[model samples]
Target: EKSSHLSAALLGEDCEISPEQLYELLQYAALGKHHNAAQPSWCHIYHQSRLAGVVVIVLHEMSQLHFYKFYLQFKHLRKVFRHRFTLPPPSANFLASLCGEGSGLNPQGTAPGLISTGAECIPKSSGLQCDPIIRKYGKEKRGLTSYTLTSEELRKNDYPMRDSPGCKGYMYTECDLQRTDSSPLFGLDCEMCLTARGNEVVRVSLVDAEGQCLLNELVKPESVIVNYCTRYSGVTRKMLLPVKTRLPDIQTRLKKILPHDAVLVGHSLNADLQALQMIHPSVIDTSLLFARNEGRRFKLKFLAKAVLGKEIQCKQRLGHDPAEDARAALELAQFFIKKGPVKILQRALKDVPLSTFSIIQFSLDPEYVASHRLVGFCEKVRNKLTDMLTIYAGPFEEDFCLKSVKKEFGKCGPIQSLTVVTETYQPYVCIQYGVLEAAQLAVESLNGAEVAGSCVKVQRPITAATLDCDVLIKELELDIENEGVIYVAGIKKSLTETDLQEEFSPLKDLETLFLPKDLQSGKHSTCCFLKFQKSQSAADALEAINGWAVKGSTLRSRHALASGHLWRWIWQMNHSSEKQGGNSLSEKMAPLSDSITASHLGTSLNRDILHKKELSAAVSSIATPQQLVMVPAAGGSVVLLHDNTFIISQGEKTGSDVLSAAQDGTKHHIFYQKKKYTDSTASGGFLMLFKGK
Candidate 1:
């Protein structure tokens, strides 16, 4: 039951999130980053076949619920989200430049090319600028194969060109004399599923020269379907079951939609033409256009990324999107025409040496930055109470019996405690479950369940006690305030502060101890507190002398409560190290505590005067921060924010540094450096950009 989570269990074995891990879960979903204390979120959920590295999360923002699809990029996919940095909206265009599209990194912010009259200029060739490409890949043949590959080349490369006597069902594209090289270049890519006869076209995507998709359709094969080829073709049985369009229908549409001499462009387009059982002249194959040494052809995706700096056909996708592939090929061909081979080679060579300089930068608006800070702050607070297992449901009818409520909700899971509260105007019941899952299950399943013929709403309880439970429990743990302090009771009324210090000094490295005395009689109380130099020494004293007899009475020794005057004094001493003007804060704490203690003497005689002065002196002797304030951010994390700078620490044990500023009066920048240390947010360096004011 402890292993079960309502949302995670639905995702199958690829994900298993416990209640305590909910904070990190939301953080990963929101920020696309791994938690400092948890493994990368992709490690758990990326392997699911149904999800395909993409998870849909329901987010509530602007008073509306929105469904967002977050893709978890594999570790080796790219360095886009791997780095640690923050960006604001204004500097979004900077990302385009880093990806080699804009002029941000270019000299004088100019596009890379042969600049003439302050604008890029390219040599023209018959108004097409493709004369060099045509001269290299052979001229289009006039026989059955109207494309570039010759008879011998077609046989060697396994291209599907039906040029022999057995070609009966083939068709040819119509020709129009009005079409020329300047006609809109259309990029074509097809996906095939293995049919009993052979590989048949299942999906076809075509894009115009402007990268706008003109035709994207899924077709059912004429022959009996065999393998859907979901991995490469991205076609599943469920998808094609509803598709009624067939190959002949698609062929007729393409023949009419094409502008006769429209330059049909693709990568290894002969295969696509063969799959469609049609012949088209005036076609450009990027495979042959960007030819390699000894007829070696690179993949269309590889060529697109290398030449155009565009990433396509990533492994994270369920299968290739023919539209995206067609667009990539079109852009690749367009780039070769615009920049030519020589500039392309130079840019590729220049980019190789600068590949190590991978830092995503963007400018952010001030409001956007502040909003992110608030989000982080809220996440920290949510992380602290992830383990709470209580819920409240209420304002039920006054006559609603407790038995009826228990019988209704107890069906969900085991209940630890159920209390009926009727002190307020409306009555309600508080329920604490034995496990977090049970509590969650009760809230989700039994929220609107009827009890005593009346509907009841179940939800997490909101109360002062529940909200402060973690902080109150944290006081009992060994922290700076309660590290070396022990409480003792059953002391004789005659014992003074010096006498108790002398009695316990030999036991360990004694700092100072506190013994409250009555202000009216100035007599010591029956209990006193002890402070040691080390936590271990205090623990040892507590264990060794807890039951020891003191003045013929058994002494009750335990760790001191971290709240009350002692904790406040220790906290002040730690922060009072910094001196304002000429005096330290410790110098200012004595009179303040003394005046408060004197005014409260009538209410409680347990306010110590002599011992507090000694403890304050001992604490001042130790080194502490000059000024410090810790605010809890998302997931109960400590963050320091001042002006334009933000710093976040893992906890008291470790920290990471992030620096940001508006620089040069035009650009905003953020730089993060994660130290090579454990318990840090992450380990890496990033340079970011934001929009400036």
Candidate 2:
């Protein structure tokens, strides 16, 4: 009616606007003129069912609405502002001036009629300034809904770095996890049963405003259920044996309860929607609300606990509570409306000198920090004061992963870290950035770029967003000294640590190697780390050995970051012996052969490398005498991650006793024994096997 009344005032009687025109005008008013006038606008008209709340209606800051009391010329305009236009009641002089009644001849050669000013007029400059009071009490009206949807670019659908369309007053977008102000909002959750065709909806819990149960039912599937799937979906055979509501019947009731255009809220709504076989465009999926990336979704339970300070879907004794899950999803959305955006705004605009733009980046990942150069770069750069960026991309194929994201995004600018947001159909890479320049560059250049076989969608971290300052900050801190490490990927299962030691011999500088294997299956990892004594040596080795084919597969290689917890690794391995436990770490690693021999030149080392005599002995027992190849060590020993393999120099080798006795006099020595490379640590953490002494 506001649009219609205003349109009638401006155009003429019967000059009514279609929902389309009203949206475009609203978009022009709220968001600056942009394309997609109808689809993405901020101006919204609600039905009578919706309770009016403050809505932020933006006008061009340079427009007359900023200074003159032109809004008062039309009574309908006054109603749009909730009758709280900032202009003060106009003086006779001001009204006369507008009509040229006092200053000049009127067009009709007569005095103009009286007009009243709404409120005090305040001047504006270039930027937007919101009317807080009016915004607080949004347009309280009903019937015929339409809003100008802003361009997608202005939207911060990213995590911690979410983008937003520049309107100060609280704004709600689709799937925003925003609390609804009574527009027939509903939270829906469904449970499924496994059938021959696939997953079929068996139960549903729907809630409405005031937490009222709108519809809760057990719907019988079309076909017999193959599995009750009771572990997660609490439905049981006994419960469904009784006459249950047919799916069509339930759908009928659901449609009656739901407005055709009502907003539906849930977690991973894609799954629920598919199970129910329903199509809803205005869905607020909590998974996307707290997404790791485009296709990555957080479990409803996670968001509830983290955002809403509540737990849901935890109790399985009674079965999955659709009500609990649905309410949890609803509450998460509410929490975002109440607090999520403010914090996201603050973090996303970290470079801005405002308290609202502050971020505590104390604990970012090291690799992330180095990759994005966050330490030296301004945290973020926006084309406007507000432009949330997503530092992730995805829907990639097998050839795509963290490395692929970094490679593509690196061309644009710095990146903190990139992680694959694993999904069945699409795998996305979630990234954190140290600087905005790089993020922006990446978003612009790589958003639609092809990655592997998929056309990747790169943008701000939405479902993949992070506001946990400590978590991201910690991850951003690099392992400073790990420059000497080299990543070796696609390791052949048939290859052993001894094989790698030989392959890596081209770079003579030696350091510990990290090659963990599956203990139960005794399968070698397809990736490992080879740390060189000199950083330059690691680089050299990477150049020499990258893509080297062995055992029917080519190995991939790259520089690896040193671990931040190197000291912790050393401490644990060194202390493993003294720690009095029946099943200690040393035990977890298979003990060496009893009858071992060693050349005076060689020594023994364990999983962590450079440990005490006890660990050394355990390492010695595992290796054959010819396997020992001594590298210079300062006093005790340095952890050598790579296993040793050297043909005995046709020289005499000694037994363990002789080797132990000759240890003090050795220049270089050999050790002998045999053990499989596949092994594990006592605590369940995996560690690769190697020979060192």
Candidate achieving the largest lDDT: 1
Q: What is the C-alpha local distance difference test score of each model?
A: 0.50, 0.44
Model 1: worst 10 consecutive residues (lDDT sum): 62-71
Give candidates' CA RMSD values in order.
Answer: 26.9, 27.7
lDDT (tens digit, per residue) of candidate 2 on 504-588 = 6666686666665433455555556676767678777878775577676665565543232321222233254345332322232
TM-score on alpha carbons, each prediction: 0.30, 0.30
Clashes of 2: 81
lDDT of 2 at 553: 61
Angstrom error at residue 511, model 2: 2.2
